[model samples]
Target: MMLSPSDRIHAPVVLLVNPAAGRGRAGRVAQAASEALRAADLAVDVHETRERGDEARIAAEASATGARALAVVGGDGAISHAVRGLLDGEAGGGARVPMAIFAAGTGNDFAKSLVVPVHHVARMARHIAAGNTHVVDVGFVDDVPFVNAAGFGFDVEVLEHMRTPGVLRGTAAYVSTALGALFGYRGFRANMANDSAIMSRKLMTVFANGRCFGGAFRIAPDARLDDGALDCVTIRDISPWARVPLFARAMRGTHLTSPHVSFHRDHHFHLRFDTPPMFETDGELQQAATCDVSVSVRAGALTVIA
Candidate 1:
């Protein structure tokens, strides 16, 4: 849905910028976005996040002060943090504030999920001004909100590797880490239960909320923003040699029909792994979990201006 400039809403908006995102360029991006928003005649309060999680803190505080919207200029991680904060506030009985994004991160998976053009800050500003807000669903992993996908096995291992020094960031970084994992990583065993069946897999599993991750890779092509359900993808055991082509096919989302690939749709599920596996939400690795991981969707939980 393309929004006209005249349709833009000039609601009270607070812009939270993460200076450290995208290799310390988020501040500049935020400044540019702020200038564009101001030029559009929108009232904008631009604030720089001093540290990690500050984006969410700032956003929550601004909403408490009667701000109706919170605009974020950063990468997926920053956006995730901000959303978590906003949802936290809502859980604590605060008003639900709408969100807008000015993509500044390396992959901007959430923006891609919304079909928001990454290179069009001016058009994004126009959309913001137009106030075209749509209610979207959010996924929860163990009751915490995640706006993107969650992964276990090889993907989680790759994210772990990317956090080390001398490791690059973005799609290339993920590819490198994925390659390393494919060559040397061993798969884990997990028992998963959905609405229809309970199954066990000895490979990789992904719960997708958004289609694209690690840049252009379409891990879940059929994912819908407001579908009120999550897509669960599990890849059964495959030899290392077979993984090469599988990885290639995943880039184009053509691996869905592979013999090892199994896809399911459900609103909720529980996953139990034989050994604790690393968990990631919106591409950020969380602490290893030994207990059953619960996943669900909050339908129409967030309002986003794309």
Candidate 2:
């Protein structure tokens, strides 16, 4: 159903902008979105993150002050941070707050799922004011929360390569880096199990709360944000040459039909790796604290204005 613009929420919202996201695109979005929000007759408070991990602190402080909504002018990485603070803020008693995504970063996959208007800041502000809110699931790996998807193996390698993605941006950056990473990738060995099945030696394992990943790949075609279960897609180890075609098919989510891919829907999955490999939660890379990783979902845990 389409949200009617006549339905309005006049409550004040605090916008947290990540200046470094999308190579400075977030800063621009912050300026435009603030203007649009004020034009809608809504009070707006704006804050800019100066350094790493500032999103969590700023978001916590804002939510503690009883902000009606927290709008993030950045990508999934910043959203991931804001979510942690908004949920765990001591002053809020760990209560959830409604959030808005401005989609001003590379690989805005989470925002894509929300159907956020990325190219039009004015429309996005109006959408926020319309207050067509939806409650969605939030996934966690170990203790880290991710709103879109989290994974290891090949995708992690792509993230590592993304750190210095040269001149490309957005989906092009992801696709180009992944093509380069796929050739040398040796995959990994791990013991993965849930209530129904067990597996080992995989190319990549993704626990998806939303459908798309890496900006372009619909890695989990059947995923639903409000569903209680996470869609787990595990790609078995395949030759480097085989990965090329798999990558192509993943763009339209047609890769699921391939024999090497296995999909499972579950509330939780436990994995143990020979070595603690790097993993990513919402496009932000993290070194695994240990070889064991626990992925689970808290259904309907977040409220967002889509």
Q: Root-mean-square deviation of each candidate, in angstroms?
A: 4.2, 4.5
Candidate lDDT (C-alpha), each: 0.78, 0.83
Error of 2 at 297 (Å): 0.4
TM-scores vs. true structure, each candidate: 0.91, 0.91
Worst 10 residues of 1 by lDDT: 1-10
- Model 2 CA lDDT for position 70: 88
In the range 222-297, model 2's lDDT, one tens digit per residue, is 8999988899998888888988999899998999889888888998989888888799999889888899989999
Clashes by residue pair, model 1: 7-130, 8-129, 8-130, 8-131, 9-129, 9-130, 9-131, 75-105
Which lDDT value does model 1 have at 78?
Answer: 86
Q: Which stretches of candidate 2 lie over 4 Å from their true place?
A: 1-11, 90-95, 164-169, 195-199
Best by lDDT: 2
Candidate 1 Cα errors over 4 Å, as ranges: 1-11, 195-201, 288-290
